[model samples]
Target: MSVDPKTRPPRASAVRKAVQVAPTAVGAFYATSMETFRCMFKRPFHAREFVQQAWFIAGVSIMPALLMAIPFCMMFVYQINILLAEIGAVDLSGAGAGVAIIREIGPVVTVLVVAGAGSTAICADLGSRTIREEIDAMKVLGIDPIQRLVVPRVLASTLIGMFLNGLVSAVGLVGGYIATVYMQGASPGQYVTAISILTKLPDFLVSEVKAAVFGLLAGLVACHLGLNAKGGPKGVGDAVNQTVVFSFLLLFLANSVITTLALH
Candidate 1:
C-alpha cells in the first residue's frame, strides 16, 4: 500500500527543495559577491579584521603550502630533467621548472591550500555566527554584514593569495634547484641563470593575478554559503564542505579562462 503523502518521510521533500533552490542559491551567491566587491571601496575599511583574518589564514596555510610545494616542485623538476638529459637539453631544466612552477603550479597549489584551509576557516566562522543568529542580529542593528564581515575577509584572502603565490614560487624554485643540481647532476649555476630565460614578467603577473582571483572567489564562496547556512550545526558543516567544492570549481574555471585570455 502507498504511504499517505502527509505520513511520508520528510527527506524527499527536503531533497526536492534543495534541488529547486540550487539555481536560486547560485544567483544569490552572485549578487552577494557583487555587493562585497562594491563594498570594498566603501569608507571605514575594516583594517583590524583584515589583518586578523590574513594572519589566521596564513597561519593555517603556510605549513601545508611548504609541504606541498617541496615535493611537487621536486618531482616536477626531476621528471623534466630526466627528459631533458635524454635529449641533451639538460641545461634548459631551469627554464622548464621556472615556466611550470611560476605559471601554473604556484597558483594552483596556492589555490588548493587557500581553499582547503583559509576558505574553510572563513566558512566555519561565518557559519557559526549564522547559526548563532549573529548575522541576523547585525542586520537587525542596521549593519550590512557584507560590508562589515565579507569585504575584509575577501580582501585578506586576496592579499594572502598573492603572498602565498610568491612564497610558493620561491620555495618551489629552490626545490627545483635542488632536484636539478643534486639529484639530476645538472649545473646549479645554469639552473639558476636559465630560470628567467623562458619565464617572463607577464607570466609572473598572470600567476599572481590568478592567485588573487582564486582567493577572492574562494572567500566569496565561503561567505555566501556561510551566510545562507541553516538547520544549525549540521548546516554549518554542509556549508563548509560546499565552500571547498564551489571554491575549487570556480577557481579552476577562472584559471582556465584567464590563462586562455592571457595566452591570446
Candidate 2:
C-alpha cells in the first residue's frame, strides 16, 4: 500500500517552494526599501536635480494623460449635471462633481498614468542596466547599488507623484468647470463657490499623500524586479511587464486602504 513517488501529493513540494521563496522575496524587498530610504537621506540633496527629475517624471510624462483626462472629466461633469438636473438638484452638481474629481479620481487617475509612463521607464532603465551587468559592476567598484540607483529613483518618483496629482487635480477641475459652467450654462460664481465649499484642505492633503505613497511603491517595485531579473534581454522585458502589473495592483490596494482609513 506504499504510494509511488510520482503519485504522491504535490502539495508538500509546492508548500516548500512557497515557504522558501516568499520570505526571501519579502526580506529582499524590505531590505532594499530600507537601504534606498537611508541612501536618500545621506546623499547630497540637490534641489535642482530633484526639480529636473520631477519635471520629467511628473510633468512631462503627464501631458498625454492630461490631454485624455480633460474630455473624460468634462463628460463626467456633464453626466452628473444631467442627473442632478433631472432630480431638480442641479445646484449640487458643481460640488458633487468637484469633490469626486479632486479628492479621489484625480489622484488615482494621475498615479495610474504615472505608473504607466514613469514606472515603466524606471523598470526598463534598471532592467537594461541589470542585464548589462552594470549593477554588478557598481558592486565591483564598491558602490552600493541601492544608494546610487534606487534612492534617487524612489525620491524622484515620490515627488513626481505628488506633483502630478496636483497637476491632474487642477486640470480636471478646470475641465469640470468648463463643462459645467460654459457648456451647461451653470452660474460661474455658483460653480466656483460649490467647489470652494466642498473641497477641504484635508482632502487635498490626503490625496497628495496617497500620490506620494503610490510613487514610492511604483519605483520600489520596478527597481526590485529589474534588479532581480534573470535570463538577459527576455528577462528585462519580463521584469518591466511584471513591474507595471505589480505596481498597478499595489497602487490600487494602497489607495483602497488609504481612502478607507484617511478619508473615512
Candidate 3:
C-alpha cells in the first residue's frame, strides 16, 4: 500500500491540459449550438425573455452603432470623394458611398457593436447566473436552459443585429453624404442621384443576411462560454472577454466568406 511520490508521474502543465481540452471544448460548443437550434421550435416559447433580451441588446448597442457609424462612414466617403474628384468623377461619389456603407461598413459596425456590447452583455448575464448556480438550479427543476434561455437570447441578438444593420446603413449614408457634399464639395444633387447605381436590391439583401449570421454566431459564442464558465467570478469575466473576441473573429470570417460568395 506504500506509494512513492518520486515514482509518481508529474502532473500535466496548464498549457498541456488546455491543448488537450481544446478539441473537446469545440465539440461541446458545437453540440450546444445544435441543441439550441433544435430547441427553437419547442413548445412554451419564452416570449417575454426574448423581448427583454432584445430590448437590453438594443439599448446597449444602438447608441454605439450610431456614434461609431458616422465617423467611420464619413471618413471613408471623404476619401472616396477625393479620389473621384481627382479622376473627374465626383458625381459618382454617391455610388461609392452606397457601396461601401451598405456592403461593408454598415454590417461591420453592427458586428463590432453587437459583439462588443450585445454579445458581451449576454455572456456576462448568463455567466453571472452560472456563477450563482442559477443555471444548475434550472436544470434541477427540469427546465431546459437552452429553450428557456439560450434560444431567446440568440433570437434576440439576431433580430437586434438585423435592426442595427439597417439603422447603421441609414446613418452611414447620411454621414457619407455630408462628407461628400459639404466637406468634399461634391454636387449634392448628383451625389444623391447616383446612390442606387452600384448598390441594388441584391446588395441590400446580402447585407441583411450577413447581419443575421453575425448575430446568430455572436449569440452562440456568448451562451456557450457563459454556460461553461468555471473558476467563480473570474471565470465569468474571462468568459465575457472571450465572447467578444470570438464573436469578432467569427463575424469577420463570416463577412469575408459571405461577401466573396455574394459577389460571385
Best by TM-score: 3
Point out where model 2 deviates above 4 Å.
1-23, 44-52
Q: Residue by residue across 1-264, what tens digits does model 3's lDDT show? A: 966857655564556778998899889999999999999989899999999999999999999999999999999999998898789888899999999999999999999999999999899989999989999999999999999999999999999999999999999999998998788777888988999999998999999999999999999999999998899999999999999888998999999999999989
Better of 2 and 3 by lDDT: 3
Q: Write the per-residue lDDT of candidate 1 for residues 57-94, one digit (tens) a residue.
A: 99999999999999999999899999988999999999
Per-residue CA lDDT of model 2 for 1-264, tens digit only, reads 988978878997798887989888888988888878777878565556556566768655678668866887899889989998998877777788778887787777866777888888888888899989999999999988887777777888898888878888888888988998889988877777788678788889989989889999988998888799889889989888888788888899999999899856
Error of 1 at 88 (Å): 1.8
User: Candidates' TM-scores?
Assistant: 0.93, 0.87, 0.93
Global local distance difference test of model 1:
0.94
Models, CA RMSD each: 2.9, 3.2, 4.4
The lDDT of each candidate is 0.94, 0.83, 0.94
Show pairs that collide, candidate 2: none
Candidate 2: C-alpha RMSD to true structure equals 3.2
After TM-score superposition, the amount by which residue 20's alpha carbon in candidate 3 deviates from its true location, in angstroms, is 3.0
Q: What is the lDDT of residue 42 in candidate 2?
A: 81
Of 1 and 2, which scores higher on lDDT? 1
In model 1, where do residues sit more than 4 Å from their true spots?
Answer: 1-19
Alpha-carbon deviation at 214 in model 1, angstroms: 0.6
